[model samples]
Target: MRKIVHIDMDAFYASVEQRDDPSLRGRPVVVAWRGKRSVVCAASYEARRFGVRSAMPAITAERLCPEAVFVPPDFGRYKAVSRQVREIFLRHTDLVEPLSLDEAYLDVTRNKTGLPTATRVAKTIRQQIRDETQLNASAGVAPAKFLAKIASDWKKPNGLFVIQPHEVLDFLAPLSVARIPGVGKVMEAKLARYGIRSVGDLRSWDIFELERRFGRYGLRLHELAHGIDHSEVKPDRPVQSISAEDTFDIDRFRDELGPAIRQLAEKAWQATRKTERLARTVVLKLKTDQFKIYTRSITPGDSINNVDEVSALALLLLQRVELPADTRYRLVGVGLSNFYEPGQLGGQTELFGNEF
Candidate 1:
């Protein structure tokens, strides 16, 4: 069994703010942008007690936690701290998979520190992050990614949990099906129809029957139910797509959509530069005032590079949208897909698509 550890920063953005400003410590903090359309990027544990959460609209978060202090996101500083944390991971193992600035998976089966176990490696990494960044991190060590991710959350805000391979099934059985990877609200509802609400309930179903009902995902459900996840931790997993989107406070007319599209395209381009791959498809996503979502995409003969080129291409895609006249849009997104690694660009042929 491969030994994997998941490390997640606790209230990352809020913690950073508190670390920089002494007065902010021990207070409820919400990290978010200001303005009508703004959504929270993170919430402190104190703010969470009032039911505020990340991704909640800033306005709603304010309503939920009237006393919460709002702070704007600082990706630059967050990225710097993230780099420091990653350096700590590299000290233990080369197989580090960063899920985001605040979280990562490390395969420490052959750790460099000569730690006797993955749990000890996780403890060392957490301590280093605390000692260096003055921030809290949660850790989980397990035989697989899904379990490790779940275990990481078992204890929050500076905690560590471990799942031995021999105890996997017992640990998973009583948990809600919602705890399973990829089993979201929709999947949970579908599973509920079959009287399957927990991992134990899911284990009773036949794999063939599950495959018949849920298709490929059903096979995965069966494997997870049996506490089996064969997937390995992939380091620096290849980038498939880079995207950025905005929600407008007021509905925007079609002719008024240029500014939003351009902004999102620039943001997406900045994200694209972080990857070693090139993008061939320029995609435009929009949501109408009625909440109807639509996407338009094109694979140009040339890979996308600059902001002007991508923004212009995305604007052209808007002309192709055949929404009824007077249909105002509430959101706009810019994305680049169909990625090709540098070496593969020589004979570059497009693969279907993948989600990042």
Candidate 2:
């Protein structure tokens, strides 16, 4: 059986804020803007007691908890801490796949640190993160990524849970059908209407009947309900594309557009740097207040070398959007696509000083 470990930091952003600022510890904290158009990005456990949650509007969050402390996100500091946690992960296994800034999957079947079990490796990594960054982490160890991910969330902040091969079925059977990935609120309600609440209920459905009702996802749900996930831990996953997106508090000024594009380019560059590939196409994504999405892309003559090139290409694409300066926007994003390895082309040297 394959050994996979999922590590997820507890209340990542809010935890970091509390760790850095001693005064904020143990108090209800919400990391978000205190503006009319802003939404909560993350809420500490204390804040969650008052029904505060991520993505909820700031006004609603205030109504839920009048005493809640609100703080804006600091991506730079969070990225630095994420890197520190990544370094801790690297010490044990090279087969690390980061799902986001605060969560990742590590295949430690044969670890570099000579760890005997995946659980041991998880314990050591969690301890190291706490020692180095003063942050708490939760971990789950199982034979597959899906189970490991769910196990990790079994217990909150500073918890470690393991699902051995023998216990997989029993552990999964009692869980709600909504625990399966991709089964959102709508699907859960649909399942509930049929008196199917848990994985056990899903197991009672015939495969053909599930396929008839829900199509391809039904098959996946059937397999997941039985604790079967065949996905492998890919150590050398290739980068298909690089992108950056931001949801603005409000529409930005036309003159202020340059700064926002530059900022997004920097973010895209940072995201691309995590991979070992070069991109030839740059794409810009814009979303208006009405939720209409628009995209424009250009394949540059040469591979994009730095943030400056990305910014320039993005600005050029922005001109294609017919919207006027006063057009209110809800979101903006920049991306790089059409990737290739640096040495894949004959004698094509690195175009820019930036290396992925």
**Which of the numbered candidates is closest to the native, going by highest lDDT?**
1
Looking at model 1, residue 95 earns an lDDT score of 84
Best by TM-score: 1
Structural RMSD, model 2: 8.3
TM-score of 2: 0.70
What overall lDDT, based on C-alpha atoms, would model 2 receive against the true structure?
0.82
- Residue 183 error, candidate 2, Å: 0.9
Candidate 2, residue 120: lDDT: 86
Please give the CA lDDT of all the candidate structures: 0.84, 0.82
Cα deviation at 6, candidate 2, in Å, is 0.6
Per-residue alpha-carbon lDDT of model 1 for 1-356, expressed as tens digits?
78989999999878999999998999999987665456677899999999998756678899998898988777668777777888888899988887666788888888899988898899999999999989999999999999999999999979999999889999999999999999987799999999999899999999999999999999999999988998887787666678988888899999999877876776686565444467889999999999999999998888777778889999999999998879999989999998887656621111100000
Task: Name the runs in model 1 displaced over 4 angstroms.
Answer: 242-282, 285-294, 298-319, 323-356
Report residue 37 deviation for candidate 1 (angstroms): 1.4
